[model samples]
Target: MWWGHPLVAVLTVWTRSAWGFSNGRVGVACGDMGPQHGPRPRPDPPPYSLSVDKPSFSPGEPVTVSLQALNGSFFRGFLIEARDSEDLQSPAVGVFSLSAPQQSQLLQCRSAVSHRTGSRKTHIQAVWRSDRNPPHSVQFLVTVVQDYQVYWVRITGPLVVLRGATESPSTAPPASPSSPAVLSAPFSSEGCGLTKSCLREPEGCRPDSDHRCVFLSFTADASGRSVMFELSGPAEGYVSFALSLDKWMGNDDVFLCVKDGGGVSIRAGYVSGRTQPELHPQESLWGGAWRLENGLIQCRFHRNSVLPPSFSFNHSLFVFLACGGAHGGSVLKHQEQPVVSGRQTVISGPPEDLRGSRPPLLIRLHGVLMLTAWMWTASCGVLAARHCKHLWSSRSRPGHTLWFQLHRTLMVLALVLTAVGFTLPFLYRRGWISCQRRDCDHEAQAGCRTGFLLAGSMQDSYSERDTHLTGPHIYGLPARQHTHLELPLKFQDTTLPDEMLVKIQITFLVKLLENSSFVMPPLLCVCPVSFSSVRVCVGLRSDGDVTHTHRLHSE
Candidate 1:
């Protein structure tokens, strides 16, 4: 009962104990060592007491513990643990082994005994061995269940002493100098880039001036033997930073300023991969202080600059800043991308300004390339091929038309840049990233279709022999021709003469046709220019005689 709920809690109740709840065996009930027995007797004193076989013990030594009924009565279930006599609120600190295995079970609290079955028993025996980091003294606490309704919680037992410890059960726990302290004044950026290595979001924001700033700063002492670190950010849960060897997040030294109730807890941890960082005991710290005000969490502490062999005073490392939700004392995954420094910074090196961005370098590059291709290069190329063709008609390039050469070069460059820009995001993310701008299934499929359409328009403008355009839709063609020119084309395998080709092949750019036979002047197309007439006539000159005449019209 003294030991509270640790991480990953689960409660198992059998039969009537599972009333009004599903899952007879696995149900979400209690977080602490107490049973979810509901209404209370104000915790009636249990008719049992804990007894130990020894009065004093050393570290890693076993001591037999017994939970026996004082009134010769039996209990249906029980939970037992050894808690520090000094800090009764902390968790248990040892491993347990049962001597009577049939009547008891070990729980997620591996250092204690819980019920295996609800069968009644008068006594339970076990052995609890102290770990290396044991307290000076301990006292056993048991929660015993009489049948089901009558159970007592946190029933205190005899105090066990550690051999030769100066502590007595009656003596109060000493005041710790490293106990969580408080800060009244807010943090500042007055000495940044001059005496301390500082990293702040928005580049040069001062924490004292801007409450929205997420800041971290470290300053080495005159002797360079230790460093003082400060962190300030607005979070309901926590704000943290990690010192990574590279841009990635694994195998890094991490620290956190967790907001708990009205105060904060400074934590030291290390990351193994992309996993939750494993927390370590904090004891080497000094001058630790924290403040919580106006939705902002701030903390500062001091530690030796020389950590282990892997980390030193002058090692270059990237710093990452992230903030996210947390429940109780466990942290949650970050909600958005974290800020990462553009380059590494040495903690003990000369103080200087630092710059960083939330998005990765590759993602930023994708945006620049795509904007240039879509907004500037592609649009200019389309205009040049349409209106500027006549400007360069007199010049020629090697074996190709000068206007066609310029148009092809510009469009081709646009296509190449678009392709490279789209591919970089996939390379950085290791997969296709969906466009969040709209509710599309994916980004790759949409981008590919757009690229194909752009390429098709550019290709069809140059290729005179493409079969799709030869279907008599001549006005849409990007070309020019005058009357009395050799058109060099045939209809139904019969060659049309030059003069007839001009009259029927297409309407002139700025001229109406002369009086024609069976003209259809009323046909109107939705385009920049209107058609005066559309007609075709062919003569089969076999044996130099007009054998037959054929006519076609848009009537």
Candidate 2:
């Protein structure tokens, strides 16, 4: 009985390890394309075939590669790599990106890409690019995992000789245009919580057959080995979804379905903070397909129920959907706030309907506080100070006039509201977010208007922060342009007899430096130095030398 108990414990430990592999964390098998299924791969011929688009390519050129089940059946998992054709034992020479990033992921070394989940797939297409200094002849080597013990290892794939060299014997056929890479029809939402989990814009809008419906759904398979996801939305450049621990954007697993001309590019990425995502190889998805009909972009894909080890161990995550434009593969920020799930959810858990909202509560309050302060309180404070001084002429409170008290209270309240509103977004996002000159958020717009109030109230303090740049970036001054303004000192002019030559070239980095109306008039009075009096300050720890361009002119 004691021996039996020990054997059962050993079996339990083995089962747990195998369970993790079943979810497709197979970096351990990267050296040799083999599964740790406790059985040698069968010697029987595989029912699969590998295909490529062209026969040969130049160095660092992209080639389309496909793995197909010849018998028209589904394969559970697969690993494909590019290797030296002459030496099969060498490491993978090129890299691969998947057409679908849902059920697959790039390996640790990025030399190959494999299934991230055990979801069944029929055909797979990947873009493999050779390195700048690739092997003279490269061949793709594939290992298809049909079952725990029924997989085929080291299946020889197509070979490509170097460009300008003689062509080798062709092993794979050309890619077919009539492949299963395109969706046959539009998605339908006939079954919601009864069959799968659904999240749709406009509450109950159906995505089935309607191009206008913005919808997202996820369903775990009956065996719980994998989950399939569908996302349909209207976006000109890109539509994306993310799995996050909370409603915030940082530290999340994001997937993008970017519109690349005629077709779509599905990619996997990770968000470090509120910045552009770090995209993974195209080989990170499974059974991926996209449809661009009318203006809506629809995509379908699959992934494992168990998240990858590199991803967090937390299975419960909040879903986020966002849309944005990408310029030449660099994705921009979402046009607006993302639609987030109300509660945390485990994708593999029981099916349930989920609802979400676009803006956070903090954001709404921030907007209200900013609008009230700027449009109402601030305006009233200025009116009381400038116009109502005579109306409340009597010193009602013994020392302070009623208008003075009112103006002070209103101004103080406006400043407090502005500061609190500005701080709210920082609290919500937990950090600063980068934005373009034109694409700033509401918080930024409000902060810009209110920032001047605080800076003007506080006396200018000589504070210096660290600077990394040592170029023309510090002052955005033109290299050759030297237009100057005049400040009067004692008249000792060299050219003009009665005029004093004090070339006032104010350099204000933080302020919006427009010499005309939009510029802050108060900042100009902080320190007016004659360009001739401006000595070069080059501290050892400072960014660099501050050049006095108007040194050429003198009195």
Candidate 3:
């Protein structure tokens, strides 16, 4: 064993060197038989080396420091820690473990620690130990850079109303000094007492004083847009108001007003409505104009209408005014002044001044509806006429009685509906009456006269009404003077012109044939005749000696 020991030592040393651990310690010994106790090989000391990269971070920003261990024998784990200048020996700011395959660790600094001049620093170190060796450590410094920016928010328009006796917690009062009552005078002055005291009462007129009083209060957002408002009456009554930011106002600016029967009272600006009476008492009115000035919106309401009042007997004066304006911002102030009685009340606000017109699509749709109704009525009349004949011919067949009854019923219905439909256009055109006065009497009397004439003409002159014809001429002579005439059948006088006389003869023939079904001819086979042509020929003959001969042909 002693003889080969030196060779074993040499081989072990070669193996250690090949593995890059040649400097590490190894033991050796020699036997007496071989050169007895030769010098023992000295233990090679463990190698140790460390490398660190520069730290990178912004002020108030998080940073990570890393240290690399190299040329170390019997390698162990590493330690990482950091601290700011505020403490000389603070607890390790952070600690991390090191592992194989490029071992590394991370440490985080508290966000509160800002990077000031020499105020922030990060320290990193790696700890490792070899077998039977004292622990060794490597460290690196981390410099922190200061980087920061300032931020803030700005608000435009009036500040929010914090508190006041009369002021609304949510909105600011309108800055306008004039009351709406004064602005809408004359028309508004006629019915109610103009005296200052009377105007203050809920009824709009104080019995003892002349001043009228109305109060309105509401909230608004940062943009001076109306949030909401409440109106109180002298009696047990009140009202609320709101509007949206987007609405169309035409040439006449929209305004809200409280008026007596004669249109005398206080008023507010233009508002929106979801339903009748310009006030959507059921839904909260939102996103409408409250006031207009200098082309800017002073206030904007919520996007919905108010809910209906819970109690039926409760009286509320809520009203809405929609005016015209496109791209108006929000409501900023009430242009009208307040009326004061016992308490300050908003009488009226700035009138909603809108800028644009309505779309053309709505007008076109209305016209289409009117035309469709007219065409439908005419078609119904023609269809009834055609179907009535079939039912009349089949009346004798079994089960045909129902069809005949239905046909008769439908014919009457169609006739009545067609008459109403035909009259509508004439009425709209104001052709049903010739009267020009706007008074109720004139209108009623004209309507009565039109109704009477229509009823009489329908009953007594059915043939003339249906055929568009006229009456007879003198001594059965065909007078060629009259061109277009429509007359009732009750007149037996034969002094009418030739065209009128021919129409009467044809009407008489038609009635005679209809009354005597037994002797009736096939009138449908007669075909349509052009009376205009026949009249032209007759008129030519009446002209002085024209001598134009015309042949009459029948098919």
Best by lDDT: 2
Minimal lDDT window, size 10, model 2? 512-521
**In candidate 2, residue 319 scores what lDDT?**
88
- Better TM-score candidate (1, 2): 2
Tens digits of per-residue lDDT for model 2, 469-551: 23343234322333222222221223331222123222332221221101121222222223332222211112322332223
lDDT of each: 0.64, 0.67, 0.27
Candidate 3 per-residue lDDT over residues 1-555, each given as its tens digit: 777999999998875444221121111100000111112111121132223332222222322333322243222222223322222123323233333223233323321111112211232243221122111211222211111111000101121111222322322233232222222111122222222111222433322223232333333333323333323222211122322222222111122323223222223332222211222221223323332222211222331111111111111222222222111222222222222122222223222211122223333344454445335633444454445444554544444444344444444454465456445545443364343232124333333433443344343222211321123431233536432222222211222343354353444434322321111111211112222222112111222222212222221
Instruction: Kindly provide the TM-score of model 1 when superposed on the true structure, using C-alpha atoms.
Output: 0.46
Write down the RMSD of all candidates, one decimal each.
19.6, 19.2, 34.3
Could you tell me the lDDT of residue 333 within candidate 3?
A: 26
- TM-score versus the correct structure, for each prediction: 0.46, 0.50, 0.22
Q: How far is candidate 3 from the true structure (C-alpha RMSD, Å)?
A: 34.3
Give the candidates in order of lDDT, highest first. 2, 1, 3
